[model samples]
Target chain A: MTVTAPPARGAITAGEPIRLTSVNKTYTTATGPLPVLQDIDLHIETGEFVSLVGPSGCGKSTLLKIIAGLIPFDNGTVHVGEQAPKEGRRDVGFMLQQSVLMPWLSVRENVTLPFAIAREKGSHIAPRVEELLELVGLSHSADMNSWELSGGMQQRVALARTLALDPRVLLMDEPFAALDEFKREHLGLEVTKMHEDMGKTSILVTHSIPEAVMMSDRIIALGARPGRVVGDIRVDLPRPRSAAMIATPEFQDISRQVREALAGEDGSIS
Target chain B: MTTIQTPPQPAVVRAETVPHTKPKDPLLSRTWVKVGLPLLVLALGVGAWEVASQTGLVNPITVPPASDTFAAMIDLSTKDYFWHAAWITLQETLLGFLIGSTLGLVLGALTGTFAVFRTALWPFIVAIQNTPRVALAPVFLTWFGFGMTSKVVMAAVICFFPVVINTVAGLSSVDANARMLFRTYGATTSQTFFRLTLPTAAPVTFAGIKTALTLALLGAIVGEFVGASEGLGVLVNEFNFQLEVAMGFAVVVYLAVIGLILYALIEWLERRLITWSN
Candidate 1:
C-alpha cells in the first residue's frame, strides 16, 4: 500500500516535521556496551502516523526513547519541529508501552495531570478534560480510578493523558502492545481515530505487523542485532480507519508485506 | 451510556500489586470483629485476674488484682498529678515525633532522589541507627541535662531513623512507570518529587509515622526512666519506688491507651491519603 502524503494539515503539527540524522546509540548493560541502534537517518512529515515495527531485541523502543529524549543517543542529531531532541521532548507527547496511569488519581485527574503540574487553571481546563475523556469513551468513568478500569481502559487513560498536553509530535512506545489481541485491535482503531481526528503527528513502535499496517500511515521495519531501518513502507489506506479496515484486502496485503519483510530477516519476528 | 468497546475482562494495570477492592469478608473477619474481639479478650482476661485475686491465688501488692488496678486508674484519673504527668509525656511524644518526622522526611526525600546525598550520609546514618536507642539515653542526659529538653531530644533522636528510612524507601521505590510518565510530561525534578513521588510515598511514609509513634512513646518513657521530674514514665517510677505496684500497672495501662489513640489516628490518615492502595 503506497500512501502519497495527504494535503490536509495535522491539527497540532500543521507542517512541523521530525528528522533524525546519523543516529547511533549503545546502552551500557551489566556485561558491556550493547549496541542498540545503529547509525540511521529518517524523516517523518507532519501529521503522519508512522510505525517502527521490529522484533523483541531490536532497538525500536530505544529509537522512540531517543526521539522523546527520555534517553540520549550518541553521535547523532534528532530534530522534532526544528528543535533538537532534548529540547524537542518538552513539546512532544509521549506514551509508554504500559498504561502509565497513576492508580491513585481518577481518570479525569490522570488525563489532566499535565495541566495540574503546570498549575494551569482556567474555565477551559475542565471542559477540555471532559472532551478528552469523552473522546476516549471514558466520560462515565472520569471520577473512577484507573485500577477500577480494565487494561484497555487504562491504556485509554494513558492516551488521554498523552493528548492532554496537546503536543504536535506524539512518541508512543508500543502503547497498545501490552493489551490482549481483541483490545489491541480495538484500541489500534481508536488510536487511528485519535490521530486522524486530532491530526497529530505520531510515531508508534510495535512488533505487531497487522497493528502497524492497520494503524500507521507508514511502517518502518527495523532489523535485529543492532536495530537499523530495513523497510519503510507507506500505507495507502484512507483516513478514519476503522476495525473494518483490518479485514480489507489492501490492509491484509500491506500487513503481509510488512510480515514478509520482518519474517525474511534472520532474527525472530513475532 | 454510549461505548466504543468494553474490555471483556477487567484486569487493571498491576491489579495484583494492589488490592483495589475489599476482599471477601466472612462474618468472622468484619470491621466489627476487629473492634469487638480485642475488648472481649481484655474483659475476659481482666475477669479471670479479678476472680483469681478474689480466690486468693493472686496477691494485690506483688501483682495487683484487675479490680484494684481499675480502681487505682479511676482514682488516678481524678488526681491533678496523674493528668499533669500524662500531659508531659504526651507533649514530649507529640513534639518529638512531629519534629523528628519532618526532619527525617526532608532528609530522606533529598537522599532518596540524589545518589550523592544517599552515599554521603548513608554510612553515618546506618552507624547511628544501629546503636540501640536505649544506650544513647545516658549521652542524651549528659548533653542536654536532666530536664524535659533532654527527654524531648531523646524522643526525637530515637524515632528519627525509622521515618528517614521509610520515607527514603517509599520515595525512591515509587513505580518506575509513574516516574517515566512524569518525565515524558516534561515535569521538573521538583514537580515530579512533589506530585508523583510524594503522594506515592504517602502510604509508606504514614506507615513510618505509625511506627514512629510507638517509638516516640518508648523514647519518651526511656528518657523519663533515666531522669525527669514529670511524665507517665516518672509517675511509673514513683509508684514502683513507693511499692505501689497497682498504680504502676495503671500508669502502664494509660500509656497503652495513648499509644492506641496515636496509632489509630495515623491509620485513619493513611486510609485517607492512599485509598487506592488498600
Candidate 2:
C-alpha cells in the first residue's frame, strides 16, 4: 500500500538535516556481545516532527542517542546536519526519560543553563529565559527550586531547558513516560503546540500508540531483538492536536492502523 | 403524633462524610518515639546508678554516687574551671574541623574527578584511616608538644577520614542522566562540577561533617590526655591523679556537652545550605 505523506514543509535541505546510514551497535555484556542496532538507515528532515514507537529493548532509545552524538555506532556513518557526528552541534537539545533538572537551581536558572556557559558581550539572556518560561506557563514558578515542583511541572522546566539553545532539533527519549495519564495528556498537548511554534526537528521515542498518533507527522516503528525499522506511517492529522482527538473516529482509525503495523511486522518491511 | 421526614444529602456529601482519612500527627507528637523514649531510658539508668551507690552494691569510693558527681559539677562551674577547659578544647576542635573539612572537600573532588589521582592517593588515605588515632596521640604530642597545636593536629587527623570518605561518595553519587544533560549543553568541566556534582553531594558531605565534629572532639580529648596542662581532658587526668572520681566524671560530662554543641551546629549549617536538596 502506498501511504499518503503527511503535510509537508517541503523537502529537507541536504546541508542542514540529520542522516544515519547503515548504522550498527554492539555492547559487550556479561552474557555475551549483545547487538542492539543492525543496519539502521534513518533520516530526520528539518522542522519535522517524528516519533519512534516500538516494544521494549527495540534500540529506539539507542538510535536517538546515536543521533544526539552521545554514542558511537560500530559500523556505518552518522551525520548531523552536514557535518560528521563528532560532537554534533550545541544547537541540538536532548530531553531524557527523567526530567533531569538540577535541584539546586531555581526554574529561571535552569532555563538559562546554555546561555550561562559563555554568553556574548551584549547578548541579553534573561528575556529569552523569561519568554520560554512564560511559554511553558511556568513564569509564576521561575523563582521556585526544581524539587518544589510536581513531576509534570518539573518536566515543563526540562522542556524550557531544552529550548535554552534555541536548538534546531529536539531529541526526546520517553520524556513523559513516567507521568500519570492526565499529566501525560496535558503536557503532550503543550509539547505539540511548542513543536508548531518552534518549527524544530523533533524525534519522540515512546511506547504509547495514542501519543504517537496525536503528536507526530510520521511514526516510525521498529521490531524488537536486534532492532530494525519495520514500518513508517505518515500521520495526516491536522495541526493544533488536542486531547479530544482521541475520541474521534479519525484518530482511532489511525491508531488502529499503526497498532496493526506494529503487531504484523516481524523485522522485515516487506 | 406526626412523623417527621428529613431530606437526604447528595451522594457527594455522603461520600465526603465517610471519606477514608489518615490522622496527621505533628512532629512534636512523633518526637516521643525518637527523643522522649531515649531520655526516659537515660533517667532510669541514672536512678539505678544512684540506688546502687546508696545500697553500697558498688563502692562509693570507686564509683561516686550521682549526688557527689553533681556536687563536683557545681563546684567546677562556680570556679570557672569548666568554662576555661571547654573554651580551650572548643578552639582546637573548631580549627581541626575547618582544616580537615577543607582538605577533604578539595581532595575528594579531585580524586573523584581524576582516575589517576584517585588511584594514587587512595592507598595512603586508606592506610591513615586504618591506623588507630588514639595510638598516634603520643606521636602528635612529641611532634607538636603538649599544647594547643598537638591537640588541633590530632583533631584534624581524626576528623579527616569521614570527610574524605563521605565527600567522595557524595560526588560519585551524582545522577548519570544529570551529567549527560550537562554534557549535551557543552558545559565546561568546572561548570558540571559546581552545578551538578557539588549540589548533588552536599547532603553526603554534611553527613561527613557531623561525623567529623564528634571525632574531632574525641581526638582533641585523647591528645590532651596524652600531654596537656589545660582543657577538659587535662582536668579529667588531674582528677584521676588525685583520686577524685567525681571531678573526673564532671569533666567528662562537660566534654560530652561540647561535642553535642559542635555536632548540632554543623547539622544546622547543613540544613541551611542544602534546603533545596530535599
Candidate 3:
C-alpha cells in the first residue's frame, strides 16, 4: 500500500489524511447505555482509498459519521487533515446509502445546491456544474427532474453533488447497497477511476467483501458488539482496478483475508 | 439507523410478480358513461321534482317545479340586484381568503420553525379553531357591522385553521435525509427553511388553501345569512319570506357556479406553482 507523507500543518488541500485516536461512542437508549464503538484507532494517509467491512451490528457507518462530524463521540480525537472534524466543512463530503436528492430540483440544480446553500457567487459556478455533470455522465439529463432518473443514474448524480465543493475527504456509507450487481460493479469501477483521477482521500463502508477488496487500497475489518478495529489488511493489488481484477488471485486473496478477519469475531459476514 | 440483528441468511432472489391485468368494464369504456351518465342523473332528478310538484306529492309552497325555478332565475337575471349581491359576496370571499391565508401561513411557519412559538401559540390556535366559526358570525356582525367587512371577517376566520394545520403538517413532513444533507451543507436556519422546508411544504400548503377557499365562500354566505343587507345569502332569505322558493333555488345555483369557478382557479394555480410535484 502506498502511504503519502502528511502535508505541513494548516495547509488544507484537495487530499488530506484522516486520523482517529481511541474513538469511543455510546448510545443512551431506553434500556440503558449501549456502547457502539470502542477504542477505534485509524490512520488513513492522503489519497488512500479505505473500506470498512463488518457484520450487521458493526459500527462502520457510525464510525464514518463520526469522521464526517455528523455525530459526536463520547471519547476520541478525530482529525481531518490537521483540523478537528467539523460539520459542514467544505473539504469533507459525506455521501449516504440513498441518493437523497431533492425531488423538486433539476439534475443541474441539484448539483449546484451546495453552492446555493453557501451563497457562493462566481462565473465559475456554471462551468463547474457542467463539468461535474459531465464527470458523472449525466450531462444529457441536466435539465431533467431528479425523480426522472433511474436508481443508478440518481446515485451518479448524488456522486456529482457530493463532489460539488471539491471536498478533500469523501466518506461513503453503503452507497451502492441498493443497486443491482451490474450497476454496483459499474459504479464501483467508476468511483475507483474518479478516486485515481482526483486523488481525494476516501473511506467507504460496505457489507460486500468483493466491493471492499475491489475499491480499497486497505480494508479495515471491524467487529460487532462494541465495534473495534479487528484487522487492517493492506491490498497489494494494482492501481486503476477493473472488473476483471475481481477474478484474479490477488483480489480473491485480499477478499479472503478481509472475510477471515470479519469471520474471527462473529462469523456473520452478511 | 435501526439495527437489525438477524442471523445471516442466503440471499434470495425474488421472482418478479406478474402485473395484474384489470378486466375492462364495457359500459365504462364509452364516452357516454363518463359524461352522459351525470347529465342523465341530473335530468331524471329534475323530471322527478317536476312530477312531484305537478302531482301535489309535496307542498308547492316549499318545493317549487324545476321550470318555475328556471323562470325565477331568468327573472332575477333581468334585475341588477342579484348581480350586485353576487358581486358583494365574491369580494368578501376573496378579501377574507387573502387575509386569513396570509395570517395562517405566517403563524404556521413560525410555529413549525420555532419551538417557543409552537409551545406558546399552538394551544390557543387549537382552542380558537375548535370554536365553531359559523357561531361567531353574529359576533362578527356586531363588531364589524352588517356590511361586507363583517362577512369578510367571518370568511377569514373560517379560512384560517385549515391553512395553519396543513402548513404545520407540510413543514413537519420534510424528509430526514434531506435535513441531514442541508446540515452537511452548513445552511443557515433561514436558508434551510426557505430552500428545503418551504418547497417541501408547498404542495400540502396548497391543498389547505384549496380547502380554505371553499370554506371562505361558506363563511361569507353564513355571515350574510345571519345578518346582511346584501349578498346571495340575503337574497335567499328575502325570497323565502316572499314565498319565492324558486328564486331562492336560483340564488343557490348561482352560488354553486361561483364555487366551481373558485375551485377551478385554485387547481390551476396549484398546477402552475408545484410543477415538479406531479
Candidate 4:
C-alpha cells in the first residue's frame, strides 16, 4: 500500500521552529565540572532539515537531546516554537542511535507505543499506525515481534514510532549509524524523503559528512573540548536527494566544506 | 533521478556447507552416549540391587529390594488413605505457592520501585530470608496449629525470598535506553512499570518462581514432619514406624512426581507468557 500524505499543519500544530541562545551544559565529573557544550547559539526554521556533525565528544547528541527536551542545559534559554523545551513534549520526537524497540512488543505495537503511553484508545490511532508502517515500508512486518526483524527493519519501526505522535519536530541522534553501509544509505534517503513529505522540522546528529550533505538543507558543524558551533553551511542543491548525489560536484563541495569545518579550519565562527 | 531502494534482507546469513557430509560427534557427545548409556547404567544398578536383595548381600530389612519399592508404589496408588494424604500435601503446596508468590511480587515491586520501601523493608527481608527457614516449621505449627494452615504458612515463608530478590533484580535491570524512550514518550510511572518494567522482569522473576516451587514442596514436607495429622510426610513416618521401608520409598517417589509436575507447570506458564525471552 502507498503512504498517504500527512495532513497539512494547522497554526497550533505547525512545524516547530527551534532556537538556542548561548546554551551551556556541564557534567559533574570526579575531579570537577566538565563543560560539554558552551555558549551554543542555533536557530532552525520551521520545516527545515538540519544536520549537526562533529568529532566524538562534541556533544552533538547532547544538543539534539537539549532540543528534544530530554536533557536540561546548565544555562541560557532554548526554545521549540514559542515555548521553552520541556520533557515529553508532544510536538517533539526523539530517536536515539539504537532503534530501542521493545523486544516483547510487535512492530505495530511498538509504533503505537507513544499513544499507549498517552492512554489513547487504540481504534482512533489504528489507521495512522497503518499509514506509518506503510511509510516506513514495514506493513508486512507489523505483526512480527520487534526482535524478529532485521536491524534496519527495527530502526524503521523506531522511525514509525517517533512519527506516531505526529510530532512537529524530529530529533535524530545518529539513527542510522548502527546499520550496514547499504542500509545506512537506504535509510538516509528514506528519512530525507519522509522529511520532505511530512514537512516536519528535523535535526540529525551524524558524524558522516556525505550524509549531512545528502540529507540536510543546512549542516551545523561543532568543535570538541567544550563543543561550540564551528560552522554553518547551507546546501543549495535541489530537492529529492539520492545516493547518486554523493558523487556529484555540488555534494562533494558541500561535504568538503563540512569536513574543513569539523577540522577547525573555519575558526571564524567558533 | 531519485530511485527508492527496496528494503534489505534480514541480517542473518547462513553459510552454504558441503552437502551429504556429516560431522563426526565425539564419542561421549552422541545422543545415545548422553541418554541411552545413563538408562543402561540405571538398569544395571537396579539389577545389582535385586541380586543383592535375593542373595542377602545387604540387610534386606533396611535396604529393601527395588522390586519391593516398585510394588509398594503400585499398592499405595490403589489405596484411598494414601491418595488422601497425597491430596492434602498438594493442596498445601498449591495454596502456599500462590500466596507467597503473590505477596513476594507485590513486596518486590514496592521495594524495587521505591527507595523508601527498600530502605525501610530490606533489612528485615534480608534478615528473615537469611535465617534457617526450616527451623521455623515447628514454630509455625505452634502459631497456626498443626493442621494444613501451619504447613501452608511454612511453605509460604520458604517460597518468599527468592521471588523477592529476583523480582527486584529484574525490575531494576531493565534496559536504560528503553527507560529513556518511555520518558520521551511522556509515559506515566505506572505505564512504564506495567509495559516495560514488568515484562522485562518476567523471565528473571519466573526463574525465582521455579526455585520457590521446589522450596514450597520442601517447606510443606518439613512442616508435615514437624507436626501433621495427614500428609505424605506423615504417611512416610507411619510407614517407617511399621518398618515398611519400601512404602516409605513409595511416598518419596510420590513427592518427586509432584515436584516434577509443579516445576513443569511453571515452565509451561513461563513459555506461554514470556515467549520473547530465551
Best by lDDT: 3
Give all candidates' CA lDDT scores: 0.80, 0.80, 0.87, 0.85
* Clash-forming residue pairs, model 4: none
Model 2 stretches astray by more than 4 angstroms: A1-16, A28-33, A86-88, A118-123, A264-270, B1-58, B65-67, B78-84, B120-131, B139-145
Model 1: per-residue Cα lDDT over B1-278, one tens digit each: 22212111211122113454555767656888968988999899999988888788877567879878989999999999999999999999988898888898888777666777777786777787778977888888899887788888888888888888777767666778778777776678788878888887777666777777778889999999998888999999999999998899999999999998988787787677778861
How good is model 1 by TM-score?
0.86
Q: For residues B1-278, write the lDDT of model 2, one tens digit per residue.
A: 22211211110111113454453655544756658877989999999999999899999887999889989988989877678888998899889888877887788777666666667777787687778877988999999998899999989988888888777767767788988887787677888877788888887777777787788888888999899988888889989889899999988887777776776777788778888764
Q: Which residue pairs come into collision in candidate 3?
A: none
Ranking by DockQ: 3, 4, 1, 2
DockQ of each: 0.41, 0.36, 0.57, 0.52
Our model 2 lands, by Cα RMSD against the true structure, at 12.8
Residue range A1-270, candidate 3, lDDT tens digits: 233243333233458899999999999999999999999999999999999999877899999988888899998799998888777888889898889888889999999999899797778789889989999999999999999999999999999999888888999999999899999989999999989888899999998899988899999999998899999999988887888898898888988888778776874665
Q: Tell me the tens digit of each residue's lDDT in model 4 across A136-247.
A: 9999999998998899998999999998888888999899989999999999999998887778999999878888888999999899869999999999988988777878
Q: What does the i-RMS of model 2 come to? A: 2.1
Task: Report fnat in order of the candidates.
Answer: 0.50, 0.45, 0.66, 0.61
Report the error of model 2 at residue B73, Å. 2.6
The alpha-carbon deviation from the true structure for residue B210 of candidate 1, after best TM-score superposition, in angstroms, is 2.3
Quote the lDDT for A143 in model 2.
97
Task: For candidate 2, write residues A103-143 as lDDT tens digits.
Answer: 87898998887677644323457777888899889999999
Q: In model 4, which runs have C-alpha deviations exceeding 4 angstroms? A: A1-14, A122-124, A264-270, B1-52, B55-58, B123-128
